[model samples]
Target chain A: MEFLGSNWIVVVFMVVATFIMGFAMAGISSVVGPSRPNKAKSAPYESGIPDIKPVRPQFTARFYVIGMLFVIFDLEAAFMYPWAVNFDVLGMGGFVHMMIFVSLLLLSYVYAWKKGALEWV
Target chain B: MGDQPIWITFIVTFVIMIVLLTSMAYTTWYERKVLARFQDRIGPTRTGPAGLLQPLADAVKLMGKEDLIPEAADRKVFYFAPMITFITAILAAAVIPWGGTIELFGQSVNLYPTDLNVGALFILATGSIGVYGIILGGWSSGNRYSLLGAIRSAAQVISYELILGFSLVGIFIITGTMSLKEIMFRQHETISFGPFEIANWFVLSQPLAFVLFVIAAVAETNRAPFDLPEAESELVAGFMTEYSAMRFALYFLGEYISMIIMSLFASTLFLGGTSGPGADTYWPLGIMWLVLKAIAFLFFYIWLRATLPRFRFDQLMGLAWKVLLPLAILNIALTAFFRLIGNGQVF
Candidate 1:
């Protein structure tokens, strides 16, 4: 009820517009476009090929390990962006929070290395 | 508290959100059409006059489809993932100063919801919360690609978020206020450079910071040139591989909404939010001017998507930490020095 004010009228128009537009478009397309539903047509797309066997490939956990390593470093980068942006304004609080974040992340990086997640094959 | 009804603000925001969502949904169609034009092919002309209804069709298809949950996935986290994404997307829109106040009941109410002194910081916080959705969705998926994509997503957000935040510090130093509404209002008091207007828009004064902000924003939103996580050629839809129906749509909506939020934020922060010619004289004109500016940024987002190639994970991280981080910090230093010298440098 609170969200039913006049201001919400614009939003309601938006929602209805999106819904009506989307439904109408898709419905119209279905009517006009060819609808040939075959077993082969419904199969999971694999570049126009029939699957011989379900291939569950095995990869060295190394792919995941390196990925995790990348994430750790990437997260470090993320925290620094805002801290750097707010450094002057935030002053000591910003600096301290950033250091703490870095320290915690560094510790995890060390742990990952100790756990051998950084090794290449 | 304030005298104006909270419901009024809520209703206003709700409507804005709906408009934003629908616009984002159609942006997808626009992007496809534009990209198709780039590739020399027609895209979706069949769905209501020039394929304008394509986005609507997409939404219906997604909603009507069966919602699937993997057996190995954690149901609690799985369900919460989409909600988390959606919330983060909506929450970040709170601080964007859409325009100046509008008169209602003999008093004027600010178009923005709340202008915390720590408005920029608030954006950062809410923006970071979005990572939780991707991380949880990836972990809960019980699929390797999804997991990898999620991890990549977290890293990407984390990496670029820093540079992004850092770049804004320059703006803060120059403006000396974190409240976006205050910043816009402050812009009205002009600094004349001998009959030639030199300092009005932050983009005019702090071009470096503006460029860096746009780059970091692109990375943060995981758009192309930084879309490694969701690179269809590689990860098969990244963290959303296993998702289906409306659940998948939630993530989709989150991404587009976040883009819109960023565009609005950029408009408010750097492009004078709602301030323009005759903006000071009329309230509604100010709002229109703001929306027009914001739409410019939105078009830029679409333009970039259509033009740029997705960046490699390594290159993205490198650009953020090595390049953008240093550049942002440098801008901050310059702003601070100028502020100290003049006590008034246009940010």
Candidate 2:
């Protein structure tokens, strides 16, 4: 707990340093850079065409599905890390436990594959 | 923990921040030089002798350019987006163990900013958070190209991050630790082969994991061959299409710094970071070795950018989910099997 507290101090320092650098650069440019906003200049670029349609078009559902799958697998991977780190101490019981967990996840992966959820098209 | 004074910690953090910013500046020059050499052209030679001062010139030009925010853009998010990206990228460096502790004015000082017990997990979390910058930047721009680019980046990062996480499982299994400093110490053991003695780097025993890790890392950083998010010909600079002036520069700086951090992470994980001959006796030598290893990885990153063509979006996703992810899992399982057999505990 003491070590964690010290580490948080470093983390806070890092956050402060990053913000300072970022804002300082932005502030310098705002002071030095010229600004003249016009109808054409303020317009978002669309390859010299008069802007048509809303920018946020609906994307494919495949992306959403992939994201959901990613969340699931990511959780599985996170759980496995601590288990893997303590493999020696956990011994045979831990080994069996992880294998069962992995096998179930692998089944999900196979089912996803068979269902074409992995396909980008 | 060394229980060092807070002032020393601040000083070290300041030095690291300066060094990282300078390196990020020079990396652009390095990339241009290497890419030019690949195409048999002299790149940026006129900007102050071999273009050593090109980044300075570029920064000055950027500072003087008009800072434009689209009239239809979300004012607050547009301004805040680049800051988020830059912060996450820079913050990951806090946990990286650069070298062994050194004595300064009769006091011992560790090379890194902080020694987090959950170092690797912190890196992963920060990396994931960085995606928010791209997503917000693209969305707030109110540009079609920017939104498309953001979506692509979201998918690409998510896919590759899985492989990246799993690839390190083998190393964690072997070392029984996630703290980078502890892992480095564990790697200090020497292994002999007849006439030669070599440091027991994770790369030697877990070559497959190392290879997978590098590939995943390259994709995670969104460099060439997997740079679908920023494909210029198709998306007009992708998610960054709507950004200009300092905002664009912040994103650019973040990308390069993240590349350096990824290289440092790789070297520390697999190359017996800062552990070389005479390193234990003299700490500065360890820092040199760590820097050298990171530079090699950075060069390899540039080389790949020059050599490989960008992957199609679908192809990139397929490679990550189908090929790399499975391979990473298999690598972990293989490592476990071997470790169990070594310990005579296999059933």
Best by TM-score: 2
TM-score of chain B of each: 0.93, 0.98
Best by lDDT: 2
Q: How high a TM-score does candidate 2 get?
A: 0.98
**Stretches of candidate 1 above 4 Å error?**
A1-121, B105-107, B344-347
TM-score of each: 0.75, 0.98
lDDT of 2 by residue, B28-119 (tens): 99889988998999899888989999999999999998889997798899999999999999999988887767888998888888888888
> Cα RMSD to native, each candidate?
7.3, 1.2
Off by over 4 Å in 2: A1-4
Q: How many clashing pairs does model 1 include?
A: 14
Model 2 native-contact share: 0.77
